[model samples]
Target: MCWKKRFWFLWNARLQPPMPDASKGVGHLWNHNALKGYHYFEIKTIRSSNMKRITTLAFFACLILSISCNIYKEKKPSQVHPQLSPLEKYVAAPDTAFRYELRSTLPGKGYTTYVLYLQSQRWLSEKEVKNPLWWHWLTIVVPDEVKGGTGLLYIGEGSRKTELPTAAHPIILQSALATHTITAAVHNVPNQPVEFTDDDFGPRVEDELIAHGWRQYLDGGGTEADSKWLARLPMTKAAVRAMDAVQQFCKEKTQKEVSRFTVIGASKRGWATWTTAIADDRVVAIAPVVIDLLNVVPSFQHHWQAYGFWAPAVSDYVREGIMDRQNTAAYQRLIETVEPYTFRKRLDLPKFLINAASDQFFLPDSWQFYWNGLVGEKHLRYVPNAGHSLSGSDAIESFVAFYHAIVNNEPRPDFDWKTADGNILINTDPQFQPDSIWLWQTANRNARDFRKETIGTTWTRSPVEFSADGKYKLDIEKPAKGYAAFFVELVFVGDGPVPFKFTTGVVVRPEEMPFGDYNTTK
Candidate 1:
């Protein structure tokens, strides 16, 4: 296409006209938001209706939109949260499988500070070690109604009410079982010099470590204020605590012997979950949601338009120079010292990445390889149509189910992610007919306007090949190139009339795949 056509497309997209059939009779499109689980009214054609009736209906429509908007808002501690449930509601009677002893003393008067030593790299000094990036932490483990000391360690990336509150999770504190409690702690990292004013990233509390890279600014001494992205400090805290310190804290809490613990988080805390698992071998399992940054820097560099990170100011790619090979001494030191994607290749742990489709903060296409990068027992519970939280009444229940399964050492059916010969093989657990892997691509490699990116702007569907035994594969057409987000999204087809819905995906960069010709494909 010529520059004329490109400009025309953008112009048309930005100022799209009403439908061609708007002159016809009134038409109402009943759009069901599967993620939020609601029926939203889309007025395809109003058809100049009755004055009084139209006014009344319009009022109701505005009311519905107002209520739905709250679904995406983050819950703050100051807000009225649900009260905690009774003691027995935490868990069922004692089960022998998830058993452990409880015996640990609480340090400090109100909150205890733990020292985190940097192990993967040597950037920390004696002072940094003694006063290592520390967060005020407190455990709410009531060992009266439970047997085992199994717990959920939530790195508080969003809440502030729990500094002394008995409940662990800011939102799901009431749902936590007596059988299990939570270790709630805030991540104490510096702030960024520049603050994002965007709706999602700006709230400040939601993404503590979202804008994480500090190499460019700190190395060049450009400007350093304070942010969770205080470079090596975050990795040190996440790694040390997830690996050994948290478990030790639990073991000490429960005088009896405690088994491994489960680490759960969302967004920036989700990134910390992966880093902690990678650093510490003691984590039984990890359930991270809506983060999808493990293999991001490399993939984001090649596909910047569709893959702009949630926190670009502090992103490892942005700070280290996105397109640069980054082999410079300073770049190499920064990569090895603070980046999470730097260590994505060797990740081995049971991960239940419960991510949603159409997350506003991230391009689903850029997240293709997030699940595949893990070399451990991993499962993808793709929540449909949800945003960053991927939430609902059963959201915490879903998380607890996965964590408990990991705790009891339940059988986790294996899922394969491999590129053999020219075929990308993906084997999932039974229960599937088969459809296609709805792949997404971006039009521009610049700042993606997600609000305006529609089906034509940022989505593409690719047909998939399926076998009799429930395994599926997608054969690449020659070696495609250029950078686009290709997600191995298994479109499950049922018996009746194929009602298709895209769930979570195994997002991967084409260059990263075996026969992935993404760089050359147009």
Candidate 2:
């Protein structure tokens, strides 16, 4: 028999079906393997009908066993830490996952000290999800050796609070898993209690920082006088402890050997930011806003006025004397030492100086003076309409934008600035200036145009009609709550036969009272 015929005969025999004669079988039944079940089954009978029955039973048995095995197998649960809650573990991890908070303290001068509060948050990852425990190791250095081995300060979750009207708040760190690390000597200062309130600007900024996933290490617990005295110190042991604390925090938390860090401050704290950056080369960037070096001189003057007994007096103080010259010299020396502007030129680090054009405390000239002395590529942004407090939405937005750009290596967006000379001109016709009318409005209709030195002069009216023959310069004062409309006929300044028609719209600021309440007719 041919090989094909033999194979078919074997397959049919194994299948044990009622086999047809070779003359009757054709196509697939004759040419191909008709009884593949032979691979898994054994023949129990020589009769084709019995063989077919046994093969059918064997196939069903195999199928049932496969299904039973699958049903019997068990799956393993995920291996996450049993000790920690999901939220806590998630916060502790470094992945771009969950947000967390960390707390530390720095030494302060005199019988005063401060607490450093830090908060951070982000999204989670799959690997971190699989193993959800988080470990943060921090190494803190002090001016002197602390008596207890436990220098770490843990702020619990309930400690996070904010005075802002918004809903977001700070996250407080409850505990940190500790590890042994290098010990550095710390200097001790007499501990004095300082109370910082939410009404203060520092706390407000802290709240803002927390909302944006930033951690703040506020050196607290000092009275205003103690803080000023600390500022006077030349590289105080307390300051060194603060820097060391930050360095250790970075090294331990990130598990990276960070040698340098950036420090930023606004308003009065700008002094501290400048001082810290100058005293330590480990500082990578120093940004101070709304600060004027010259203001230090005036600050002393104010200090004397407030507390004359405590103030140091020097005759001809402006020209010479330790009280005046020492501070001036100190200011110059600090600028020279930090070389804040030129630090990048020599050390490849960045320095930024920010101020507001309308800052009440520091003059714009003071900023210009500082900017002029800078040797390296210095960046200066003069925010318009921002005050010394820098509390407005515009100022906060600018600060946030600048901060993320520096810390996260993100791109900064371009901003357009409007100058004082840019007039809010109204042009009735696109082509001709003669066809337009301009009106300047103020908060009060009775208010004078200070720009023109005119008192109680109003320019709030809409021009109703213009005569071709008359020289019209009409001023209409509109109601505080309504829109004012004007119609005017314009001609060339000298005199012209041609006239163009114009209309303008002006909206007054909303009044406090409801219209019905203000109306006598009601």
Candidate 3:
């Protein structure tokens, strides 16, 4: 026993010079120790030392090996982990086939716009899709008075397959100058007019692409190979790569590294904004405009209940039979892969959901289905007298305000609301009292539908005042003959450039489901 103990001391002194602190990880140390331990075990002196010493030495060697292996594993990056979400896996996948070229630069009133042509990536092989190469015209608005390292990314949609870049969007430029932050807008979000097969695919740009990919995946029996071909993969990849492009381009051109971002978009682009935030950590905040159906399954079902028939706006989804197969296991898998609500736990940053009071694609009261399930700081605004397009409305002002607050690290007004008895109750932070409050209400005597096209811009506003208890309450009176929808809008006019507007979830009187449940006409 004394001789064996002496041997252990000599062996330790000779082999282990001094193990590095485990925090830096065991990289080469593991290999060196493993090989040395193996050779040491084969020595004849160890064999003659006796069974007790041999067993002790083997146990000690095993203990050291386990620690070294764990140290190496601890240092591995989370991106390489097997538990990555489908969106994360797709976006993080290495794609060296990417390039960007600065097409032109134009000077604005107080900002400079750079038009860059970006080839994001090749989605699938040419055998699968006609044009796998995804390209876009990106307009980056660098304000003369840039504030911080953070920039605003607007994921916009367009179908123009042109040789020359078109004009920059007025709203994007306005936001850049208003917020005084570096702003960028990426067009052709999915690289439109792509031919999937000999078939026309459809008239729409983004939805048709999504439906086609879903059809292929569903028809192929939901294999792993089929999942990889989802249209959302390239859509999300495009936004992620746009950030990469801007960061690199800004560094090289302006000599200012825009490291952080706040992403905004409307319709399908809004959906991409949510997924992009989940896929990339550089997104400091998000303002998803008018894509309100987050918990997709329940929200759509609620849509069916409100309007006995599916709105014509969603005909693209109906044409591809995507709406009909919403109840299947394959559809659930699809939702898990691409739906933002599936990854709700990951959306902890500030989110400002800018919606329309009468969106053609979604119901005004759709927030009830998914709002409570969301975690972290969130704000909602349903712009009155507007629809899916939000044209001729001031919704952009609210969005710009939200982005400005996030980029400047300014505290936005905090508020919450709920339905009680026959009225909607709103309680705001005492320190952050709003400048004004109004109740936007409308009634539909013929049906439960409140689509902008069906009801027009009939929503009227009435001044609302705080009660004795310091909570603003709006009386939700059920129409004697038909259904009515109402919400309280709080306009917070602070020192920011634009007034931040937010609203309580819209409440519809006579809460009744006219359509019973989701019934597909397919």
Candidate 4:
């Protein structure tokens, strides 16, 4: 007999002794027979005189139970490996397309945590049938520092065709000529997903690219609940997993190794962009616009306020579970674990820092503080008269300039605040005290005829003035002559005659003045 058949035969024969116990019909008989059968089976398997005697004795004992048994037991065939279902096969296939969904876990009462889905697409064409572009993944770090960190939020995407205005088309077209793709991401305090959205933010950015003739794919739907769950998750593991998923997606879709890509994040999302860059080497460039990096204090407060509605439940959960055991040391441990991976140095690709002079949440000074730390091929653009929402004309122009510089290897031009040539003069009087305040006069002298009219005829009063102490003043008149601008300096020499220095005319244009760092000399 085959080994399989023999194995089943022995199993059935052994089971026959116990089969008499149908509805407790053979309690003692089954037990007694089963014991005898075990002994007989073991002895028969051994070949010896002693074994034969033992087997004959055991067999006789079990044989006595056969007299009372009449009914036979039914047997069923066993299965090993089961057949694959249709859904299983489809999911397992490498060529199928799938949309990404976020999964989140909440570990605290006041915080949200999330696992963002990283999806990539295959490039399908007649010439390159199976060519695919790898998918790159990233995660937003809320208050990006604290352990059991909560109050993270993400916004959902809006309709591309419906939301973006016609005026934004020109800007988008310009950006497309300079960038491989147009993308955007979000960031919020831990456990708060207030403003994250793909339609309102992502599609608008993509629409700008689509207007410029590039195919676009944008997907993001981060909410407050998502943030709470993300907060409770371990930052280091999530970051590693996100990076892996992105790399795998990219490799699968492109069929080629993906070594470099860009990451773009605005507002709070800019924090995520920075964190992702620090975490992964594959990220080639990072554009973080209007980021706040002065301190974590303000962010922590903002997150609490932004996500107050969910705090009660999240807090309760944390108190009941793992959070109650945590202290400052525990939080520090988490930060230390993720800091090395999330704090990136200079990159091989372009890094753009864009901000507005009057940003509400993130001050101009904050951008200066953060960008100063960034190394490598870096560029910064500050828009005047622009607010927190940087959709203004000046801001858009600055963004376009940055994109062009990065893609085309063009250098950014220096800022200038001049139109025409004119000279400014400051009037100084000797009869002023050391601490006395005095009003000064400005002279804008436009030299009309330098050949004949020398002193009085060519002299014009340019709107510029100075104080006795040489501390503060204003330019009342704009220049309109030569390529020169001027200012007056006052040096107070006690309460007597004060020495004055008439600054040489310096030519300046509106674009030449540096923003944010006002105290360059200091």
C-alpha local distance difference test of each model: 0.41, 0.30, 0.76, 0.31
* Runs off by more than 4 Å, candidate 3: 1-81, 198-204, 519-522
Residues 52-97, model 4: lDDT tens digits: 7777787874454332221111211112112322111111112222
Please, what is the TM-score per model?
0.50, 0.32, 0.83, 0.33
Cα error of candidate 1 at position 507, Å? 7.0
The alpha-carbon deviation from the true structure for residue 149 of candidate 1, after best TM-score superposition, in angstroms, is: 5.1
Global Cα RMSD, each model: 25.0, 31.7, 14.3, 28.6
Residue lDDT tens for model 3, 442-509: 99998998888989999999888655555876786788978999998898887678898989888988
Question: Which regions of candidate 4 are displaced past 4 Å?
Answer: 1-174, 179-259, 294-349, 367-371, 409-522
lDDT, candidate 1, 1-522, per-residue tens: 122222222222223333222114211111111200001133343557586688788777655644543331233211312231111111111111111111223343233323221111122233323222123333343333334545555544312122223233332242134224334333322212223332233323223323323433334532222222344344334334332334443345544333445676676667666655554444567777767555545544434434433244234434334334343454444445445666655566667776654465565545454555556566665443355656452445566555555545555444455655434567765654435555433332333323222323344555555566766665434324443333455544432222223334533334442232123111
Candidate 4 residue 507 Cα shift, in angstroms, is 22
Order the candidates by TM-score, highest first. 3, 1, 4, 2
Error of 2 at 238 (Å): 4.9
Off by over 4 Å in 1: 1-133, 147-149, 158-163, 170-213, 216-232, 238-257, 305-329, 344-346, 368-373, 391-395, 417-468, 472-522
Evaluation by lDDT, superior candidate among 3 and 4:
3
Q: In candidate 2, what are the lDDT values of residues 68-172, reduced to their tens digit?
A: 423322211012223422221221122221111233344332111222221121112233122121112122333221222222211111111211111111100
Q: Show the lowest summed lDDT stretch of 10 residues, model 3.
A: 29-38
Winner by lDDT: 3
